[model samples]
Target: MEETNLYYKLGGQKAIRAVVEEFYRRMLEDELVNEAFRGIDMDRLRNHQTAFLSYALGGPVEYDGRTLREGHKGLNITSEQYERMIRIMNDTLRTFNVADEDRVKIEAFLRSVKPFVVGQ
Candidate 1:
């Protein structure tokens, strides 16, 4: 049987970038989470996120960014903010026609990493 992998199903780097773009666009427009991004350099953030997601999804490229915990340090992110970001990501995946199973896998991956991102 052919193996299933999120990287391939997500169409590799290109698709990952697309999803990140849409996810950020949604987040930037949402008042609830937008405050977290204040004073952040969006372009740099996007590049780091694209690489991180690509690597997380098991794509060909690796993330050259900071470790998740280090990266999120001092951010003071709450569980609600984390869930909001995940919701935006899921919506982006749906917009890209990602299979439901794959979307679920993506979400599961995010949840697994939540501790590194939320709270002190």
Candidate 2:
């Protein structure tokens, strides 16, 4: 199956949105992660995160915003921070009952974005 086809078959837009929401919720409650999100507009950040994930997961939505490196330019996000974000995302996917195959795909996609995200 094609990559995009796999995303749709795995539940498409709605499922991706759910996973993003849960991931942010976990970030908000975890003090270490919460600090990174502090002072940011939760609703706006959440929406952008959703859009980014939608495009990354092979959905039809076209992402046109700044690339992750530029978007995260001044944040100075560390490797540890990136790892925490991935961990939270994986846990959120698990909570949503995402199948292992889909989870693996998502993880690979996220990993590919890490360097850009941290401006490495």
Q: For residue 103, what is the lDDT in candidate 2?
A: 79
User: 1-120, model 2: which lDDT tens digit per residue?
Assistant: 356464575587777777777788899998766777768998888788888777766677889888888878777778888888888878888898877887788788878888887843
What lDDT, from 0 to 1, does candidate 1 have? Answer: 0.88
Compute the lDDT of residue 43 as modeled in candidate 1.
93
User: What does candidate 1's lDDT look like per residue over 1-120, in tens digits?
Assistant: 123678887888788888888899999999889998999999999999989887787777756778989988998999999999899989989999999999999999999999999995
Q: Over 4 Å off in model 2, which ranges?
A: 1-6
- Lowest lDDT block of 10, candidate 1: 1-10
Candidates' TM-scores?
Answer: 0.93, 0.87
What does the lDDT read for residue 17 in candidate 1? 88
